[model samples]
Target: MVTAALALCVRTGAGAVIAATVFLTVLSVTLGGSVLADTPLWLPAMPAWPLTATGARLPVALVLGALLLTVSTGLAHRELSRAASR
Candidate 1:
């Protein structure tokens, strides 16, 4: 997710940095294998503290996806602005 965000940021202004940070952090946690188990697909389940499970990773992935989409949109807008300025 962070990679996508970085790509987006490359075109967009620095405004995307916050979103990138949030996404990358969440992704790192998820990929680290520390989250709740048996979480429903629709809801963000709060995993028990100090627990580790694949189910817990879903929320992080979802958040990261959202961040990626947002950053990509921003990048598109930035590119458009640049083109218009030229």
Candidate 2:
């Protein structure tokens, strides 16, 4: 998804969103992995020690990060397609 966003940013010259999208992508992956590992069905620990204590906040953060990425991707795609048609 980050890759797609980067491509869109490049094609549309929307460099401003690239750093933010990359950061969010990394954050979402980290939180998602931590949440998965926290589950009883998975392991008790993750390599991300800093995230180990996020507790319930992890889920909220993950969801919001995902939402931001989704919105960014959609807007980027829309802009890319619009640019292509011109």
Clashing residue pair totals per candidate (backbone < 3 A): 0, 0
Q: Write down the lDDT of every candidate, Cα atoms only.
A: 0.52, 0.56
TM-score of 2: 0.44
- Write model 2 residue lDDT over 1-86, tens digit each, in one string: 46456656656556655675666556546654655646541222322433553777567556755776788687767766777798
- How many residue pairs of model 1 clash at the backbone? 0
lDDT of 1 by residue, 1-86 (tens): 34445556656656776776666557545643443234332233222212432466657756755776798677666766776798
Q: After superposition, how far is residue 4 of candidate 2 from its true place, in Å?
A: 9.2
- What is the TM-score of each predicted model, taking all chains together? 0.36, 0.44
User: How big is the positional error of residue 71 in model 2, measured in Å on the Cα after superposition?
Assistant: 0.7
